[model samples]
Target: MHSPSVSHRNAVDQILRYLKSAPGKGLTFSKNRDLEVVGYTNADWAGSVTVRRSTSGYFTFVGGFKPEKPMELHCDNKSAIDIAHNPVQHDRTKHVEVDRHFIKEKLEKKISRLLFVKSEDQLTDILTKAVCGRVFYDSLTKLGIGDIYAPT
Candidate 1:
């Protein structure tokens, strides 16, 4: 690296703080017969204070060894869900990137189904937003994450 600034140091500090705050956190999986796969996706549209660029993320969970049936994808943005379901492209959808059309293809093939979810219930928020502690822990719990080192 040629040069490092205060911003980099601050970022490292923030990461260290997060690690220290949750040292024992881990994911646990057990034997299960149902192999249902569910995914949650969200985008912070122009949520950045400095650059105003949208950032998106997704999280998926598989209950067993093999995924069964059509994968359920939950999204908080209704417009995105609509676009994914609509077969006919409109003028407004012209600006959407080419890669996004993959979702439409998947939908048409019955590989996945897109569903609308409320913002508060969007489990992907923990990955994309600086949510409060309550929301963060709740999301983690919903995702089957637990503290492995906790006393029994």
Candidate 2:
């Protein structure tokens, strides 16, 4: 921010516009019959061309009254999912060995189960990606976010 560029200013203005358009939109939790926790994880492998870094994200949903069962975690990256389950370390995944071991430990203790999910169905995309129009609205609905002023 030492020397702001035109692109940065435009991006900020766009965000402000979106915030103004959905000032009352927010998450609305409701009670349900089933008491369970579901989680979703996704990673954009080598998403940044400049730094060649991957972006990973996850979300957990606590349903009903209490924790009924081990949380179900859905992941879109097969390699990351495999790393979490496999105890043997490999050269490619050595950098993330700590994270792999942590998730593996959780799996062994039955704290959570890692499951595969299609990229299109991953609800956390809204938070991690710059999506708009139908895709954006769809993700918001799946995340239980709605406009308070809109009629049900």
User: What are the lDDT scores of the predictions, listed in order?
Assistant: 0.83, 0.82
- The parts of candidate 2 lying over 4 Å away from their true place are 1-12, 64-66
Model 1 per-residue lDDT at 61: 81
User: Would you list the clashing residue pairs of candidate 1?
Assistant: none
Using TM-score as the measure, the top candidate is 1
Q: How would you encode candidate 2's per-residue C-alpha lDDT over 1-152 as one tens digit per residue?
A: 58777876997999899989888889998767878899987767787565686767788888865577878998777877888887788889878878888888889999889999998889878666667778888987898889989887
**List of clashing residue pairs for candidate 2:** none
Query: What's the TM-score of every candidate structure?
Result: 0.84, 0.81
Index of the highest-lDDT prediction: 1
Error of 2 at 88 (Å): 1.8
Candidate 1 deviates by what RMSD?
2.8
lDDT of 2: 0.82
